[model samples]
Target: MRRVRYYQYGGPEVLTVEDVDPPAPQAGQVLLRVEAVGVNFVDTRFRRGPGSGSIFERPLPGRPTGDVVGTITRVGPGGDARLIGRRVAALAEDAYADYAVAEAQWLAPVPENLGAGDASMLAMSAPVALRVLRSAPLRPGDTVLIHAAAGGVGHLAVQLAKLLGAGTVIGTARSARRLDFVRSVGADVAIDYSEPDWPDRVRAAAPGGVDVVLDAVGGPVLQASLDLLAPFGRAVVYGAATGKLEHVPVVSLFALRSVTGFNLTAWRRANPDEARREMDELTDLFAAGRLRATVHAGLPLTEAATAHQLIESRSHTGRVLLLPGGLGPGAA
Candidate 1:
């Protein structure tokens, strides 16, 4: 087996691929012949330093990509034998490898019609997008704003919001090209946050301001999002891709508007059953062609460093994926 690891954290240069012995699954786990892996900002954060918070019990020299899609090759004791040879998507630690272990209970069967890359892309972002939308009070005909809407979670949030009956879907990106891409994914209005008056643009587009705002970019963007809300509108903060929101005053909540933070990792830890239900719903949506997984780039697993560079650039829209075992864009 081969895996990507880093001895010290700083930049993409630190990551190196090494050949190693394959891992054996422990009780209640299944060993997957990994087909695809999803690369996220969090993976870049982990590579840069330890500030991202720990997912493992103890800090290790290497970190894992969180989303994986593969076929079950081995099942440990207490794991379902029937799952062997089944294709599934799951959240796995140290998934930047040819094979990885995943808890059987967390695995979701991938619809046969879905490609491995799309399955891996959806494994993490779709659930988070669905959960974020559910956290807010959304009504039919309500206008919704999604910041960083061309990114992994935001792209899915755009489609899911429209499918759930949002009248107008507004998405913000950093460039005109990116905004155009966001519009193709269901955003009724696309604003380039790079523009100083992007918030003003959003207001003009929605008239009375949007009813719900999904913000992943913090700092000034979060503040701007809060200001663009209509009366009683909800702003759900999911990530701080730019930086942390600073000096948010109590006055920001005027007019019954509110700000709520959503951490998918924490939410999943607290509501396991609900998490499973959300995953099922996302899978159904994908199978029915209602949800499309946008894959920005796919590279061979050994090129993990290159993948990291693309993600950190923030220029690519949608999920970046790594294909293991010689798999490429069109592989089944």
Candidate 2:
């Protein structure tokens, strides 16, 4: 089996492709003949360096990209035999390889309407979007603002917010192209956050400010998101892609506004059953044609470095994927 690994953390240049023996499924796990792998910003973060108390706690060379979709080839002891040969999406570690082991509990059957690339993309982003929307105090006709709305999770969040009855769905991206893509994904309005007056534009669009703000971009954007909230509005902080340190100000507590941080990894760790339920809901949405994942690009597993570069550049819209098993070039 072939896999991508990094001996050191720095840039995309550190990624290397190598052939090695495939891993076998352990107890309560299943071995997947990986068809598609979802590349996310977190993979790049892990590649750069270890953050405090994060999964990347060390600088050890290893494979990244955990979101995977494929057919089950083997089931370990205590795993359901029926899973063999079934197409499923799973949250697995080291999924950049041709074959990866996933815990059976994290696996969900891929719907007939979903392709391998979309399924792989949905494995992580959809569930996180669903959970975040569900956690917020949302009401019909409410105004919602989503940061990084053209990226993997934000795109899904836009559609889910509308489906859940948000009256005004506002998305922010760095460029017109990204904002246009965000609008196409069900955002009622899309604005370029790169402008110094982007928050002012959001306020003008929403009138009395937004009722809910989903922020993945931190730093000054986090503070701006907090300021854009209406009275009693809620802000959910999921990621700090800006690489800027942020702290909630005491003044943000006025007007009954609240800032809450959501970490999907921590949520999954704390609530496995809830996580599975969210995944099922996302799958149902895809099956019903109410939701779809936008696949920006698909490359060979060996081109993991290229995928990372694209993501880091923020030039690609939607999810970027990697096809294992030598499925390269024209896969997209």
The global C-alpha lDDT for each of the candidates, from Candidate 1 onward, is 0.84, 0.84
Give one digit per residue, the lDDT tens place, for model 2 in 1-332.
89788898889999888899989898999999988888888778888876522544455775685788888999998878988999888888888888999988778898765776568755788888877877776789999998899998899999999999999999998788898899899998999988999988998998898899988778899988888899989988877776665879978879789887788778889997888788888888888878878888888888899999999999989989888765543234
Q: Pick out the ten consecutive residues of candidate 1 with the lowest summed lDDT.
A: 50-59
lDDT accuracy of residue 246 in candidate 1: 63
TM-scores of the candidates in the order shown: 0.93, 0.94
Model 1 misplaced regions, further than 4 Å: 50-60, 245-247, 329-332
